[model samples]
Target: MSTTHEVTNQVPPLVGHDVAEDPALLEALRREGAGWAEPELHEVGRLAGSEQAQEWGRVVNENEPVLRTHDRYGNRIDEVEFHPYWHSLMDVAVEHGLHGAPWADSTPGAHVARAAKLFVWGQVEAGHTCPISMTYAVIPTLRANPELAAQYEPLLTAKTYDFGLRVPTSKQGLIAGMSMTEKQGGSDVRANTTRATPAGDGTYRLVGHKWFTSAPMSDIFATLAQAPGGLTCFLLPRVLPDGTRNRMHIQRLKDKLGNRSNASAELEYDEAVGWRLGEEGEGVKVILRMVNNTRLDCLLGSAAGMRFGAVQAIRHARHRSAFGSVLVEKPLMRNVLADLVVESEAATVVAMRLAGATDRGEEILRRIGLAVSKYWVCKRAPVHAAEALECFGGNGYIEDSGMPRLYREAPLQSIWEGSGNVAALDALRAMARQPETVEAFFTEVERASGADARLDDAIEGLRKELSNLEDMEFRARRVVESMAMVLQGSLLVQHGAPSVADAFCASRFAGDWGVALGTLPSGVDTKAIIERALV
Candidate 1:
């Protein structure tokens, strides 16, 4: 035996434990009326924490999806080839009904339970959730036309993973994608020049190029184009009802910074047949439904990233030692770990609350709260991920440590649904357009009044900011940040663990924090917050 390769002082692999064991996740699950789903959630958690599942995540990322524009016989197949493990990962996602099942579920808090499960399993891999979320989101938009919804909703919500290029109606289940942005209009979807013409019947012929289309291999897509009336929403499938391929050109797959496991393509639609999902000029209105749902997923995915980083950082500290003492026993390291746990917990609780709002049909609260949280929580992810990775020192910088992957995936959620400015502006827009949404948001925040003085004062300050609408757009980020902190503080004060809430109020609301992470004030209950992560 070689004494040099002893592997001493290394943290053991984190596997075979339930990722759903966290108290905050479980507490939110119950509070949101999804306690009945605890057993099912644990099942998902166990599989997500398995070594085999972890390997599936790693293998797919290493072997990115390959684009197959043609067959051996020179036929334009327009397909994407993923590593076998990618399908395995997607199979589990579909089998667990993470895609569109919640829309048809009779269970109480269906969306909330699904959101919690997504937050749990996304820790395994973050990319595949993109299509799953799209499929889930497209259901409502597809309902803009009753006939189309009736024809496809069953297959869309089916709990089966039918992976292939086929007629969407014949497939037992379906996966969906979204294609709207073009080079001319990045976020300004109205500038889309993709023109659509009526074919005398109900179908329309679309001809234009998409700058970015996620999950290109999906059975169907919710697309936008300029129709005779104006911008319109339509449902386009890869294979037509007559069993022939649509006139779609797979230009090229994007070389992205991360999320390589999922295929994003530049596509040209050459008179592709599409059925209008909504009336002409209502494309933006219809597609916003899909955007809101995917935004919820952005929140979940970022929270899950936080959880992944915290678990890895804490697991390493518990075992590895320096200065002849365990890292967890050191004072400074403890503050860092506790702060990470606090951030993760705040994100999880608020995300689940929004999910619960969706389930309860509290549209006012969801509309405003999502935009606020999306701006603040997602913006925090990259910073949180960097701090967590630093806890492992040089070791975390390596690929095998998994911290690099987490760090790479962190910035995506913030960039995906909407960037910081867009999200913050959305919150302000919601406040102005739908004054009731702003009222609903504050009503929820005011629940914990008198429970914590810092929270009460924060709420008061937030009100003052809202009253003075001067320079609102310029101060959008600051106003949204205040709203997010107050809402999170209220939730923690009301439902979260006492120590976690205390730490959140002291550092986030009161002026007891530093600019960077791991700067919680002294005398805070570091031990208590860290134990919440351990459980």
Candidate 2:
């Protein structure tokens, strides 16, 4: 038998016309819009009572599960075993979503925001690594290892009333990080030098130092390595089968500019026991999925930071009396406040659209949405933060005042979870696979934008911008800009319209108003009936 098999897989070329023209989907989107402004947040808090805030506040008040405190010479302070605040928050988050808690949709995204703010408050604002670990390390491990699930199910499922980081937080766990960035090599996972060799007895040995492992103290490490086939992922347990220490050695923790508190470790793997995830050459594929989810986290974090910074500036502007009036009273400062609102809300809306795509089980769409949302929000965080900080004047530069932390942490947004460049490349690749999706995305926006007076002008402005996308260079620019436009339209129609007609409106927007129809050379409204809900 041949070890190599030619797998001719068809992705069924996705066209923007199909989704943009989905009448039913648009109708559903329109119907969903009526309740767009429905006070889900207050309602959830009121219904859940202290339970909602209590669980969430733990993440806000306490430090996360993994802590990275270093000494004078940059030596890592060995695991201090802080109370498990981050874990408690995760427990609450899982329960909230599982039971369809009132703010279920909002809770996950909101909790992420709360976690980022809390990190900001602790001055360890830079140590925002738990969210990625929870998604990449914790969730995937639970899916792969039922034994571990059996051990931790209670924690993951149980409803907790207590607040702050809980203690005695022990469970079969997995922690994930990256090693793609090397001294010579960049984030090209395909070029990773980490090697793993089968050690017989269903175990394998991993040898090679990874450049960066975010949460170093995790019991299991979802580390990537290279083999005879191609890039692959391994469940590198921190301990051996006998529960003794494995050869997974930590060389040193990185002294990064921001996210300083999240100890990013450089690891040396010496014949570590590792279980293969999927096929030997398929690690990149599996990890890419995991990374997409992380990108969502990154967007959520960027939004949270923007929200926090905005909140800080608003508070100061309203309270601080400058030039005989509050900072917010000055027209210039007020304009800054308005800018913060727009930027922050824009990011929030994009994040929400990505979340909605995920909730709807559109995995392909979800990846694109996640990529765009991450790029958009993370890119805008610095802009919003700097503006907010400028409003603070000299106070923004002071460390104790909180503005400086946001300034310091804002840049990290563009660096993590597949940086902006990486995200751009991946997004382009996805668009190439589903060329029509780009068009569908925009057409829906145009349809929605044409209807809404508040958004029509902006939509029209964007339309003119895309008109230049006729030639190859223009098409290149159009692809990126068009991606953003579709996302904006999706968000506006998804969240801005009235709730009762959410589905309808969204479908209509997709079909007649989207950029997909305008941009695709071979345009076809495949889902027009669904978009119109005419059937």
Candidate 3:
């Protein structure tokens, strides 16, 4: 007798669902006053979680961008070629106004809505967001030079996306990129040696090399160069007004560990034509506007990663069986999934709150709040991804499981915009320079003080830490972590389900948990949390 093995208890592919339709996400949006945009967000969610989007992500990363520096006739033509699927993904993002939607729309919840869209779309493919984020960030910085803004704002805000290499004057739409760090100065832009000589009428000829020029094929870039005064910001267009290529030479592309779909190039500018932005020596002040916005994107990206991981883990747990029971029914595995759900929900809530702050014109709150969120949310992503991947056991270790990609993509958020140390220092600087920022941060946290005793205790401890200035920088990371936890606890107590808040406070603050995942204390409703996270 011949016997055949049957495939039972295998999980189906997670597709054909609308990610925006998530109950938690929709509730968060409603709480944040952006529920009116649910229809549009649902469309984006559907597309992002679709099989086509998954295929696009695979093909784009597999076929990385190729630099074609010279044409067939040996003439210099700096361009990077991407797979058609990459273009399709970009087209969808651009059409949805992910690039400049908030700036273009002046409604009450514009920023919140745009952030939600980005969060949803980023879960599908994160690499293409390089240009989208840069374009969105460039608006405020470009305003420093009203002349430049007048010349390009319409083009940048245009809903259409022109994916051709042409003069900005001829293109229907445009995207922006940034080149700040140099070989000697990774994050210290002041140490850059790039020299800019005055040409004529606020224009300069820049001659230096940029260590990393993200989205190298973008139509324009905001770069830093040394001028007569000091390091200054300049706008460099890929194609000059006369329809000729700029003197920018693409030396080579960096082989990165992840975000492979985007091209990060090292290029030398041999007297590249550039227009000075803002006054000389004010580059840091001007470019900081752009950095702040990108920092917010980094936070949102991390939150999106967490959500993706949590959903995948929950779905896998519900389907796969082990030890004569489904993983979701296993006590320890249930605890792990529930812990991740709490984490993902906390991140989503904090991110939306920050966006709401931006909409409310809470400048001080936004400044410090962004720093706190950027530091903590991005930092938690790698740990969350690892735990989620472990739920699939051996299958998750393979590339086909999609867990490895999420894991690899997790660290980039913490590193980009600003590293953990940088974010913590920035928070401290905000406190020193603007005491009102501290007040704003505390004011937001104190709203939920009386709701949870654990959160109240954590906040009191953080207040004590903030009072002592001794070894502040040395203790910055610990202080920042505490601040992050207190903030998350406060938000959960105020907005999340009672069970979630209790679980978070008990494990995170009351010391009922160990150092790893799956250590939630007994009596917590782990099954409910897992169900909430399930797709």
Which candidate leads the pack in lDDT? 1
lDDT of 2 at 263: 55
lDDT of 2 by residue, 126-162 (tens): 3434433333324443344455445443443333422
C-alpha lDDT of residue 224 in model 3: 93
lDDT (Cα) of model 1: 0.93
Model 1 lDDT tens row, 1-535: 8998888898889989999998999999999999988998999999999999999999899999989999999999999999999989888888888889999998889998899888888999999999999999999999998998998889888989999999999999999999989998888888999999999998999999999998999999999999999999999999999999998888999998888889999999999999998899999999999999999999999999998898889988999999989999999999999999999999999999999999999999999999999999999999999999999999999989988888998999998878999899999999899999888988999999899999999999999999998999999999999999898999999999999999999999889999988899998899989988773
What lDDT does each candidate get?
0.93, 0.51, 0.89
Off by over 4 Å in 2: 1-133, 136-180, 443-449, 452-482, 497-535
- What is candidate 1's CA lDDT for residue 504? 98
- Kindly list the per-residue Cα lDDT of model 3 for residues 423-530, writing each as its tens digit: 999999999999998898899999997888888888998899999999999999898888888888888899888888889999989888888877989999887777
TM for every model, in the order presented, reads: 0.99, 0.68, 0.98
Structural RMSD, model 2: 15.7
With candidate 2 superimposed using the best TM-score fit, by how many Å does residue 175's alpha carbon deviate from the native? 5.4
The TM-score between candidate 3 and the true structure equals 0.98
